[model samples]
Target: MSNRAKLFGALSLGACLLWFRAAAEVPPETVGQVAELPPMAGAHWLWVPDRLFRHSILFDGDSGRMLGAIDSGVQITPKPPLWSHARKEIYNVDTIYSRGHRGERKDFVVIYDSRTLNVKGEVEVPPRAADTGTGIALVGLLDGDRFLVVLNQSPGTSVSVIDLENRRHVGEAQTAGCAGVFPAGPTRFGMLCGDGTALTVHLTENGELDRLARSKPFFDVIDDPVTEKGVRDGSTWWFASFEGLLYEVDFSGNAPAPKEPWPLFTENEIESGWRIGGAQHLAYHRKTKRLYSIVHEGGPGSHKDPGTEIWVYDVPSRNKIDTFSAPNLIAPFLGPQAGFDATGMLGSFLSFVLPNMGVHSLTVTQDERPLLFVRHSDLGAVGVLDALSGEHLRDIDEAGLSGALLVVP
Candidate 1:
């Protein structure tokens, strides 16, 4: 070969290698980009978290647009963000782990500015009992959002009271054997006990535990237990039992006065296997005084199953006013296969063999035109429905948003 041809060939090979190296070295963008979002009027925030990334995302319920996010640091599991109406601050409770020691961990209530989403302050919460991860109400605001209550489960169950105004952890209240924190009154909260009673804790002006009391055993805990995720409106709380019974408890006074347990489903409906289900199955529209529950056709041990229908009830009359069918409950099974796609056929077959895919949680937006945000865990989708008309608006599917606890501010 000629010397010129050999030199040309060598140069070409070198250039090709350089180009390939440059292409390979190009970097991918970060998994989650932290961008400031413009404020939307009447917007509600959704607690969509990528558990793998240890960050909780706040999404706009109206447009399914991501408003902002908070980094919970490495190996941290953050509770749902609590919005303070009076203080205009967002509070998040997270279990932060130490960098060097895997066992070393600390709990912190991180506060953020409502408008800017900036970290305002962080108060360290002492370690207490952990919970079952059933998406229970772990954090609550009392005294017109001036104080914060966090449920702890370090084997020994108790609640940590945080003085948000003072930005300090005041004290802890012994909940006896009860779990979960439920706002009962202006300066009081309640916890569901294992023995079917609710232990109510009252707070003083300084956010200290003033006293504690327990209600009479209202529901059967073992055979048919009430869910911890009850819907509260004013001083009344609607708790649903495993067998589809609604126990209304009025906390207007010192003790939790229980009303008669009303059957959520009639005898005929029960015969057809209609039951209340889901982690966060029930939601209440306070302004409209409507109660919404996710229901499905399942037998005794199917409380965790996704719901096929949403039953709306008038809170005052305790009568069913409307029902909305949830078609997305099985839409994931069909996939992209129209009729004869092999993969789609396989998906459908597997779906039938597997458990039902339905709504896992429900929340009503605090907007003028309130929309119901339904979270489907198995499909990793959120469906928006008209609160009054029960019209399915749209579905938002994003990866890593599964099993997210919904919060409306």
Candidate 2:
């Protein structure tokens, strides 16, 4: 192998070793009992993360009806901070979203209630969460209880597991450079690292990081025709579908190289399709293994009109299935207090479609209802989409966004 390749390999090994040492020293936190929210017999809640301000938690009535917005009193100030992954406990706090400001995290996590929509509690992220120069942190819950947060650290990135049961910071794993994180199985997770590599890591005894198969980037060529025209920002802005591209690796750790790379979507030639002028919300379907993204029709900032498009891809087959468009989308006009007029004024704005860019966040209901959450480039409006049938649900007014999605078991 070339000298550079050998050096890169050594660096990855050293980083992993340092992380393992840290994990061993950090004992698990004592998870306090989860407080339950007051009974809301027929209400369901979803989270919205804004870029400029605080995250917003919204409530929907039974059968997917629009109930109204939940007041998450926390306001994440500053112009370019992040409030990511809003989630609620089963019946207690309405939701919690991850927040960090100016690259420094003020709170590891924040919580909210369902009935009154008030701030409930806060938790500290594992020591690994405060890494600097990392962009686009993704958080997830594993086996229904444990919390996992992954992000790229300057010069590298790592994954940390929070012992929610004990309510304390716990295990962590240094990973390949990453931009996104996904649950591959019960104890296994997948990440597309920042260095253009995709890897799957399995949790061993005590949350140790086990080497899994990795994949090299197959579609690495930049489409100059589009990018040169000032299109395609390339900032974690692409989506994958059920059969778009699947790279299966043998991560048993018994093979020659535990950190090898492969591609899962090689059989079909998957290409970028429609573009939502200023779109930025993404959703994935587990059963169908399909990926969908939402884009706004107009330019960023102003919400004159917003549109929706659903791109279906099969990950295993690496193919594009179909596309649908919804010209009408609802825009929410938000106010400062609980007495704000949020009724009847739900769906107001419209969005256009932009191709290739992945979504910021997305989710599908049990009944196959695909809900995509998107923000206007420059406005404080949010868009919800029904991807399966291309139905524009409603748009709610929110500010300073990062990521948004629904809570699923």
lDDT for model 2, please. 0.39
TM-score of each: 0.82, 0.54
Off by over 4 Å in 1: 1-44, 50-52, 73-77, 99-101, 327-356
Q: lDDT value for candidate 1?
A: 0.73
Specify the highest-TM-score model's number: 1
Task: Report lDDT (Cα) of residue 335, candidate 1.
Answer: 30
Please give, for residues 237-292, the per-residue lDDT of candidate 2 as tens digits. Answer: 23322222222333223221212223222332224322332222344565566655
